[model samples]
Target: MPDKTEKDQTQVPFGELLRNFVIELIVYGILIAIYFYVALRFLANPLAALFGNNLAAYAVISLGLIVVQAVFLEFVTSLLFDYLGLHRLSSRPGKH
Candidate 1:
């Protein structure tokens, strides 16, 4: 027989899970919207020119921009989640 510690036995309520999920979704949506707006507003002309001038450079730049966006969004989301006192669904017990 296996011993069940309190941590192992505990379960998150569905309501709390749903709430956290909703909050995360909303935050990500807003962040993505803002990111797109800023990217398009500032980089559109430059990227368009690059694309016209050099295909390889444009492709590399586009890929780099995507990576940057993903990292930035994830970083911001973590900060926001900490600030909002929300626990990540994927986080495991005893792990920061």
Candidate 2:
């Protein structure tokens, strides 16, 4: 009774989904810890100085840094997921 597209769509098991979520959470936590350590260790003084010297520049630069951090973390996480043999779950049908 189902069409080809409907038949091709498969549901991921709840337990597997939960497990993957937990794994990703743990990995992200670890990466974030490292990122914080590096940022504070290296960037604290420079950012502070910039903030004190120029408020507008500091705001723009800070925003840029946040974007860079997000992109870097995402890329690292994707690589980590692949290396750990975990494939990202997709909502689209037949597109794992």
Candidate 3:
């Protein structure tokens, strides 16, 4: 029996890797952008109501919440995709 080695790992072409990376960035960017957009809107409405139409405070708090939510959601989503093997599968060569 032969021992498995780290060198046995398959290498992806640089061009393909760059292309796939760009695609992943586009996908994640769109999803995360939408998520934060909705989150900001949702947070702003209630803040406005609670603050008696004070737009400045509402904007500040809502922006803070949006930033936090975006970071947390993005981290969780990235981890979930990795754990589910989605990222790894996407980088593989297509079968003909």
lDDT of 3 by residue, 5-67 (tens): 333235556676566667666777897789669876776667769678787887787688779
Error of 2 at 5 (Å): 9.7
Q: List TM-scores for all candidates, in order.
A: 0.66, 0.66, 0.45
Error of 3 at 38 (Å): 1.1
1-96 per-residue lDDT for model 1 (tens digits): 966433533466778877876887888799779877986789899989999999999999999998987798778888867655465443435533
lDDT of 3: 0.68
Which whole-number lDDT from 0 to 100 does residue 55 have in model 1? Answer: 100
Winner of 2 and 3 under lDDT: 2
Native RMSD of candidate 3 (Å): 8.9
Candidate 3, run of 10 with poorest lDDT:
3-12
What shift in Å separates residue 24 of candidate 2 from its native position after superposition? 0.8
Cα RMSD of all models vs. native, in order, equals 5.1, 4.8, 8.9
Show pairs that collide, candidate 2: none
Better of 1 and 3 by TM-score: 1
Clashing pairs in model 1, backbone N/Cα/C closer than 3 A: none
Clashes of each: 0, 0, 0
Q: Where's the lowest-lDDT run of ten residues in candidate 1?
A: 87-96
The positional error of residue 63 in candidate 1, measured at the CA in angstroms, is 2.0
Candidate 2: segments with Cα more than 4 A from true spot: 1-8, 77-89, 92-96
Per-residue alpha-carbon lDDT of model 2 for 1-96, expressed as tens digits? 955554444566778777877887898898788878986679999988999999999999999988987898778888866654455454336634
